[model samples]
Target: METDYAIIGGGVVGLSVAWGLLRRGKSVTVLDGDDGSFRASRGNFGLVWVQSKGMNQPRYAEWSQQSAAIWAEFADELGDATGHPVPLEQKGGYDFHFSEETLQARIEDYETLKAKIGGNYPYEVLGHNALRKEEPHIGPKVVGAILHHQDGHANPLKLLTALAADVRRMGGQVIVGKIVIEVSKPDSFRITCADSTTYGANKVVLSAGLGASKLGPAMGFKAPIRPQRGQVLITEKLPKLINRPSLIARQVDEGGIQIGATNEEVGHDDRVTQPGLSGLAAEAISAYPALARAQLVRSWGALRILSPDGLPIYQESADMPGAYLVTCHSGITLAAAHARLLPDWLEGTGAAPDLEVFSETRFAVS
Candidate 1:
């Protein structure tokens, strides 16, 4: 099939970009891998978080804030299109700190970042008592929190399903079980899959999550991406115990407390371990004592696709001008920006956001 863009990877990142292209009246085709793929979209903490990001790079913080600002409108449109309400609560999110020293240190970092961003960073430090006033279930072990207004949580699975449905409704072809093995630009871009099915497009996007590491070099990208395993746990449905999400846990829209995410450098081994689950439970209980009574329902591990510097990469292949590489660790958080703003970058329009900092050249050796 011939299309304006052939997107490799049907995860949230790929689909969000495809959705944006289709909204611009472009013909698109999405080629996705089989069930064996290491899909982080399926197993994530689901936080549209902005705190503790871009601590070293202010531009990343600005980019995240832009995406978080548009998330509510984006979710509304997706819900309207697919009839699946992507439950999102963007009132704010907290970064709970058990020690006064750490909380104060983070505040200092935020102050520096705020100045760098021209005082646009919005956050407040709530002491233990003040935080308890908002979250009655907060335990005494929790000392304080920095609530960033742009942070929030959402039902990530629902968002993924809605995006897939809406992409199809917009007449975009989503081909599953097609593992793209080779991509070459011979006049028009040609993508050869394992099954010998060839697809042609004017432009190509390599957003295959962890799979990009293999395909990116051939397309003139130093994809420099790696897989870090994160294990998470979810409790059975119960009365709301968390009013806001933290790095430790959040009470999901369905009343289940989602406790997560131990960052382990286990290379692509996405297997939940006993120690990982135990550590998560201990931390959650320390944050909210009530979760100790909640029954555990599910535990899972997923790989997070990360660049060396832990920032999103947006670059067009130098050798092949029409091929683009888009990948990020926070796909859930950046879905809105990808769907609404990134199409301009891919099209090389004058309206493109200033994404020069995200290019792979930043990783070039001296």
Candidate 2:
């Protein structure tokens, strides 16, 4: 079939782009992988976070803030269309600290980044007393917290469901369990899947997460991406014991305290280890104390796709025009930006956000 855009990978990144393009009257078809593929969207920590992001590059921080700003509108639009409320809380999120030294160091770094970003960063340093007042369940071991007003959390699964439903409702074709094997540009673009199914499109996008590592070079992309394993845990649903989300833990909308995310550089291995789970539990208990008595309900691991500098890479192919590469680890956080803003960049419109800093050219080896 012929389409305006043939998107490889039906994950959040690809689907978000498809949703945006379809909203603009673009004909799109999304080809997703099989069930055996590593789906990070299903196993994420569900954080719409902004604190401690883009410390070195203020542009990234600004991009995240941009997305965070529009997430409510984006979610509301999806809810209006699909009737699925994408639960989002932007009341603010925290970077809980166990000692004053670490908290002060982070504040110093944030101050520097804030200046670099023209003082747009909105955050406040909360002492133990202040933090306790905000979160009475906070443990004494937690010395302080940095509450970044832009940071928040969401129901990732609901967001994904809504995006898929609305994309289809908007006349976008979503083909699942189809692994695209090759993409070639002779006149337009021809994409061949492993099962010998072929698709024709005027433009193509490779947002296949970790799968980009293999398919990228053929499409004239460096695709310098790797997998980092993140192990996460969740407790049984109970009364609200947590007020907001921190790096250590957050109370999910369904009443379970979702504690997670041990970032380990295990290179494609997404298996949860006993040591990782124990360490995470210990830290959560130390932060909330009440978590020590909470019943542990579920635990799992997922792989995160990362560029060399831990930033999103947005590059149109140098060799093959009309081909683009979009990949990032913070899919849930940047979903709104991808759906609402990224289409402008992809379409080369006058309103496109200046994304030069995120181009793969930054990774060119000099």
* Model 2 clashing residue pairs (backbone): none
Give per-candidate clash totals. Answer: 0, 0
Q: Which stretches of candidate 2 lie over 4 Å from their true place?
A: none
Instruction: Give the Cα lDDT of each candidate.
Output: 0.94, 0.93
lDDT of 2 by residue, 216-279 (tens): 9999999999999989999999898988899899999999988988989999899999999999
For model 2, the run of ten residues with the poorest summed lDDT? 49-58
